[model samples]
Target: MSEVIIRDDLEAMAESGLLSDYNRRRLTAARPTDGAMLALNINLTAICNLGCTYCFAKGGDYGRITGKLNEGADVESILQFVKQNAARGETVRFEFFGGEPMINFSTIEALCWRSEALGAEQGIRFLYRISTNLTMRLTERELELFARFRFTVSVSIDGSEATHDRNRPNKAGRGSFRAILDNCYKVRERSDDITLVARMTYVPHPDSSLVADVEALYAFNIFDWFQILPATVSRELVRTVFADAFGDLAYSEICRLCADKVDSEYKLLGEIYMLLFRPGNRFRGVLEIETVIRMLLEGEVANGHCSGGRNYFTFSPDHSIMPCHRLVGEAEFRVGAFGGTIDGEAVAPWRLGINDTPVCRDCAIRYICGGGCKQENFVATADINRPDPEKCRFQFRLVHCAIQAIAESDAAFRARRRGVLRDLFVSCGRPTLSSGRSEEVPAPDRLTHLIPLLHAFD
Candidate 1:
């Protein structure tokens, strides 16, 4: 694994007033008051066809007994919930999620049509997105509905065939790579209007190579964008499946193993940096890299880890509501029900900004890191406010890479690619200077000094 050198100079710059001008402004920026875009992750079913090794949802049932959403009552409750929360002319995003949401395709169809009708009546615009494995064949009607709704399809395929097959196998222990690929092509052939995102999960195994996996996936040239995320494996989940293999292993050891996987991301970062030089490079903007770059370019900082527990809430198949989809099985995270009132106090902790976390407040890259993922933090440390040290190290490295990319890129290159880069950022759901600002704000002068320190990594 690559090591990040936390130089004293960089720490000093953050602690003192040198970097505070920009950092403080970002730290103090008001959080969005009125929730403009309310994202509701409707967990259609707890049942999935595939049994992933690192499945946090515990074989698609979220560690609970198998259950699926009721197309009738559940659909009605969801629509009612939206009506209560959203205002007229406001946009409500229904993100179809599950073990494999395709298991409840009927529910999806019903909800989409019903929600569209409701939107028309109430003057509320509704948007749709689905996170599916793409192992199932979609009917002509399903394809038409997706194309008409312009649904953003996030397909969960882990890079290459070898990696994907190993990480995600069917219940019968068979490879699903071929089926998923065929379905991907089918969906792509259906419509150019639908946005297809290749969501790759990086599992830390001895045989796994992140760079090779990404290259194989990119070669297909089927996806419009790529979202790569590290697999979050809890000790309980590991013990449940591989107790005999990991019986004597400590939780700390498992965390160490996963933390080491950050090196793969570091390697991929180098690939992304190189792609910047290639004109019309489709693979240049990975979601992770583009997010940091977007923040740097727009002078924006995250008030929290994500919209979870705030505007973003997950509705489980059992009618329970949780702060995040990852915390679906946990009872403590449950703040409300489908048609019940949400407990504001229960969700407040997740609303904490980066400046609010004591551990993150002193970090050099606190503003950029946004205290890491709250769910990851809660899983690792059993506390939402505290962050995993290794995760913190990874964030620091990522932020440094973003700074290096901006500092090293020539003015001519930046000027030529500014428009393209802006579009990439916006597509990733981040607002740029075009949102309100008339002119782009130049990065702080102190950022230049860190470029020399960043060279140590090279």
Candidate 2:
């Protein structure tokens, strides 16, 4: 029988997988990062509308974000960063993120104008994007600016009104669902490129309600795709609607439930290219994300999804740069700031990828889970080595349920969606395609859900 392994020994085993010195030297010699990476998130204001308890900024605490807001990064400060990056021959893409980036629309506009002029002067086209709460008022001129500047907006919507209002209530404890829907219509009216990224924070009890939950968001014309975030409840947040589900089920279960009902969309989105992201429909939402997963492990990621701890940094409007947005407030967690550059030697080491953390270093699942969520690690203070095993359970469950869903569906639709997902993931498994140019990946239809894991078993 295979020997029963323990966590400590598993860590040693993980390190054992590291390349031999000779190979290490060779891979390092490749000068891996070919050119300057594209894009940087310039967070204009830390202020936000609805203050979710787990918000990385630890919102509403002026002390938490000592940095000033309501102020734009002077045209000079932003211009300097852009020119320097452009000089390095890297095309610049500006992303405006904030407590509610819309709150700082004034600053975003300033940056947009400057970015356009700068992009033209340098002969580099600037890419723009925004993530907002939608309830905040936005003007036609603002919509026009996005159209003119070509801002790809992702408005956060949490599933149906009950689910949304339940978890994402406003400061006054009223539901913000209808407000978001209203804004979404205006956005769709402006352009099809506007993406409504529905975010569902799961509370454990609603398994049966999953399908309707997903379908409700689909009713919103602009909800191009959905993003599923594990619902969080600090002790203080327990009084709200999602309080019980916080750590009740594994993340794998969350994924499985998601996969079962809306697996195609949620699972596929997780695997898309981080940089130059484009939504895929050729992928009927069934695509497996192996290539994308492998790509992230290989250190290629965009939009902060696979930060691997270095490419991007999250600042609490005050400028305390945490490794990324995922792990914002924990005291032990803060890395550096807008006031300081991360230590070159340490940045790579501090990266959350490559089984670097102690928990990951010893984990048998590190290759698959990759130290789990970077922020979740912050949630596990004393024992980051003990990854939130709940997530593992959730992933596995999502796969099982999604496959079941496919089984239950009309064979024809399932086959088509599965085929699309299969083709996309199959290509990703190939080293050539998975490791191809990192700028942007042409998305095929979302492929068969869970094909990536099925491939693993095979």
Candidate 3:
């Protein structure tokens, strides 16, 4: 079993300051209800300026932007989808995704205003969020709108100037760190209280500089939290650069090494525990904890093919619905279109385990791994009916390592505390040598209270 160090101090650490007053109020008012929790992923736009190699959306010239596909989704379609989602009494969270949501700032702003109006009339609490690549083009007003709506803005950068530029370079093939930093500084200069999440991808590397990179992000004082992801690509998704551009092993080790170094970092520790214990926590909700942590920190918790049974529904630019982001554009994976009424029945087939295939069925870690990446199946294998072995092996190893670490932490606490207490309790029975009526010495067997913590600790 791989060793994991889960500190005892974490449970007592302070709560996240990044958690908004609105969220606190919402969490306070409506606890985790069995009532539906729906996240409407509006791929508002697919046009982006940066030219990162592993962009899943194939960003920029390859796709559309804002509330519509290249065909454009009308206000009616978006409204209709929102209404149907609301009719179900779900806790609706609206998330803007794209090549760059800032590109479609007007649509996003309008949607917020419209959603506020409609939700107020309907009495639904509409929460907003967006995932973006921070760029200079975003206006001050747009940043204010995000703050006003409590829309958590999650931005991206690779890591440091060299690292970030090497992987997430611009179209001119130049490092974007300087431009990204300028944007980050502008946000902070405008609003110190604004909650910013910085997302960085983990590319394979021998020397782990992530801890240092995190410190540097801290130095800039822009990001409130840091998000890490293993830059993902599927050879089958697109033939152009998949084989030549997708290999990065250091990202995986960065995560493993990060677990070791950040064990005591107060904020990440809470996320780690949530990823470990809570099924619904944003960090663990992706079905695979490690992968989801990166996504959660990036403010995109994908209720993938694995979590479709849980509580989520995704809408592409066209408002055609799917189980998760990865299923977009793939005809067979579409649960149902948002063009008409959203029939609960039409979307039922994509629920967890329903689409699970042969490799998953035989694998021991299927449930924890959720039969591996659904995106991989779509882009890597070209078959929703199959599980990608590489994906499965990766997740299985990660989950197994996570579980083992949890167990070892459990074992260490017990073994040490038990030994200490056992000695203390046993010493209480160490009678004087002169008082030797030495009863039938109930042997060293009856020390019950001393080891009682074994139950709860384990």
Candidate 4:
């Protein structure tokens, strides 16, 4: 198991302004659902070129709907929905999704332009994002659009060739690792400012460990940000639907592996940045703990994981709407349909906050955790309204590991060992000064130049 140094002085550190109210408030205040719809995920198509074993959508599988799209009225309705939400003074983000989103590139190009024009006229900011397998070659025009629009692209690739190709293969059953890596390089070459996040779905193969998987991502060298999700498949679903591919890999088994190795994962992350020359890029495997500490410092409580229907919703290619991208397929989960009326009754159940969940009401760390992910709840309990015990343990472990990091960082900063604090805070995009100023310290480049003497301590 990985180890994170835990200090018992978090309360004292908070009192000493090691945690600033200004920074904490600034973070928690930017809640996705402050007033209106925060994000809309538009699935342009269900047909992906690569067939990943853990795909929640079952992209190429015949059992699920694929290659569907919104026609004239449905398209108009989606646009109107965004415009209406933006009119309410909310900054709305539109995410492009797919079996592979690039498969429907033409539609995405058109939609991006349309959204930008609307945002310009209405004084609304439009943020664009895409989650793709990155197997196709990107055109010059596509790269130019990404640069011009400041797109945040999340490329889904598992770590290492053997591990990645075993789970994620193209329709022809060949490895996609090479093409995806090449595309990532092309993206970096095209734009330096664009945020490239590498998202990995970890499968507990008999030969690999989580630490090794994370190291594989770092070896790629292009991704500045990373998101890691354990491959989650319900026991019944695996047996009935994807028996050949997933076999007996259960979500609980995955959770147990992670819980046992939490400390090992923590230590790896603490030392990970030392392996690279650059100081800016970050791995977010358990990065949410920083946010949890910020929320704790501010003395605030939050709803469960996501506000779902209230803050964000997914508009599928067929014009059906669900709470999020993860809940795309089930008919019972559909809350509304574009070009049609929204059923408030259907959405009401989803809007239930973390406070509404019975189990979470008494939990000590509910403020940081919210409840658990809604999709995982549905998978474990067979009821979207219920919380999953397996996922609860996983979420709790993340919060616990995060608390450990905060304690260590704060203790080190007060002891004049700000170098370690600087490294940890670099991932947060800004460093909290031990000098107790409400304002943030300067950028890493500016601070690094001023701190040549600090390296003597190192």
Candidate 5:
């Protein structure tokens, strides 16, 4: 078994900007994001077959608040919107979202077919992504089309059979893991879709085992890309919806769970990377620590948490627009309608970066976190500017772990680390670096206040 390795030289790396570069680049990416509207989300339908207990959209069970799109008018309007934006030479990205996007397969197909032809004719490039539960039976034709279009499909499945079944059961209260796995096999057989990402939502409980859960997820081997999200629950709605699933844990406890889970995973992967000399392992979780590694490796920085209401936004079934699909029907978030005139000014408040927020500006991890998630903040504190203390602290611990993993390695590995940091410095337009070492930033202590863990394999 591998053990956690803490390095004494962590503060030196933090000072030289090698450790701090991750957050600095993230903050830089968040600000002055170049280009207009790079990505757009199309919520195909408000219906889902598998009713996940942690679903924010409530499985789209509600009525017209989950609007039904008029196929003819809605598809046309969405295409026009894309064409208008694509004219500016930006490679437009369209994300098909859901209650299970496959439920509205016809709409997705039509939109893709038309958009592909239009993009080809107009000399505008396009990329398509879809988020699905992978429970709906997929046809060979659908797989073929997805492969041909090169869709970056994201399948939602939590950890193992028992864990997944408990939270993401179908309407009949049966586990959907087997069915999803079978479908995934089919998807693999049909095509080599390069970007297959597995999205896991970590709903922490007293019984939760972060190690076991990740081990279960990695067993399949079908997914090389992964992202784990901590469940964001509203306090008022917790009593009505998440009481049984989450137990009596507070939001801070949930954040602590997320922090520990991330630390464990990072250490596990770091051990693997160190043993094999494989830097590719660093890309395992693109949306989490892996993203920081990638940004450093490839020399990229990003603005705040999300580009919602900024360079990208979501389009609901009825053409209503919001910052992102996660905030679909939120009243405060609904900036305008796609078919109608959208008030750009209404979205300006949401586009505020880390520099704009008074609380975030003073945070050590502000640049690294890009002010955290606006939707999560809004749900937790009823204010997007109010940073979640738990998440903020979690980021500090993660960065600390990542820095230690790199800084404490042997002298031979320093060459590889220097190459990545040198590229990062150049990419962000910073002065070329002589080496990766920098002035020391104090290493945050391991989060000892974490909730107790049950034996993972038990």
Candidate 6:
């Protein structure tokens, strides 16, 4: 067994001020960023087959009436939107999203084919991505299309069979875990080219074990990557659970409780340590950890929490445009509409760099943490510019782990693993280097600053 980083180690580092010093240096070195638009998130449908209790989308319609994209009219408008927004000769990604995107399979099919033709004509290269529950059956044609386009398929399966079934059941109240697992096998069998990512939502329940859940998913040996997110309960559910409290108070209380539970339950540092150093382990990289690792390895600083309104925009079924997918139903976040002008003023705040925010300005890990998620910040603090303290604590811990992982790993291990990460980034068409220059892995001696703060995993 590999050495694990315990909570005491983190506490020790904090007490010694090593973490603070490191963050200060990083923050001082941070640069301003103005992100370019590169991807379009198309909400194919606001309908899902599964009835997840904690769905942010309110059972797929974002609390509105259910609807899907119009294959003809909507497709054409989206293509036009892409042509207008995307630069010529640029490689842009079209992300298919929904309550269950496959519900509008024909729309997705039409969009892909038409977008390819449009891309060819306009000198813009197109990439494809989809986030699905994977409960619906896929046809051979669909599989072939995905393989041909080299689609990045994000499968939403909430870890263990019992946990997943309990959280995400079909409308008919039947478990969908078996169906999803079978479909995963079929997807893998169909093509090795398609990037399969297991996206797990960790709901803090008595039966749910974060470590065991991750282990169960890894046991499958099918996913190329894993993305684990803590469940954010819907406002309606929070109201129901806290019947006495009125609107805003209920929301605030729930956010606080959820954040506290997530922080307590997510033993990220130890989990990452084990995954990286565990001997003979079938460890598929977790997206969150890998992102921080990449940032550390490349000495990259984040411009913002995410591209969102700056470089990324989500198109709704009714032609509404949102800065972030999570902000789909929010009227305040509606930047513009398709076939209309995008409000530059509305997007300007989201475009601000991490250091630009007053709350994040003095933060040590502002450059690395990206000020946390804007929508999450808004949900917690009612201000996009202000970050939630609980989330900040979580991000700080994650960054600390990444630093230790890098500082402790031997040169040979890092070199071997570097290529794996590089290939993953390249496959996704994301920038391998945030500095926009040659990436140089800092020598062990150069990382001596962090070495003392980190416990060796041997």
Off by over 4 Å in 2: 1-39, 51-56, 60-63, 66-75, 85-93, 123-125, 206-208, 241-305, 326-336, 352-369, 381-386, 395-458
Give the poorly placed runs of model 1, Cα more than 4 Å off.
Answer: 1-36, 237-251, 276-284, 407-458
Quote the lDDT for 438 in model 1.
12
Question: In model 2, what lDDT does residue 235 have?
Answer: 43
Total colliding residue pairs, candidate 3: 12
Per-residue lDDT over 297-409 for candidate 3, one digit per residue giving the tens place of the 0 to 100 score: 22221122343423455666655676666556655556667676555654554443412356655654332343544555655566654765545555544544334333434
Ranking according to TM-score, highest score first: 1, 6, 5, 4, 2, 3
Residue lDDT tens for model 2, 133-247 = 7787767978788778766665666678877776667777788888888877787688755544454555534443544565666555455445455454344444444454535
Give the alpha-carbon lDDT of every model: 0.70, 0.48, 0.49, 0.60, 0.61, 0.70
Candidate 2 differs from the real structure by a C-alpha RMSD in angstroms, to one decimal, of: 9.4
Model 5: CA > 4 A from native = 1-32, 35-37, 61-64, 236-286, 297-299, 404-458
Question: Which residue runs does candidate 3 get wrong by more than 4 Å?
Answer: 1-36, 61-73, 87-89, 189-193, 205-221, 236-311, 343-349, 354-357, 361-367, 397-458
Q: Least accurate stretch of 10 residues (summed lDDT) in model 5? A: 449-458
For candidate 1, the TM-score is: 0.83
Cα lDDT for residue 51, model 5? 69
lDDT against true structure, model 6: 0.70
In model 2, what lDDT does residue 16 have?
40
Which regions of candidate 6 fall more than 4 Å away from where they truly are?
A: 1-37, 238-261, 276-283, 416-458
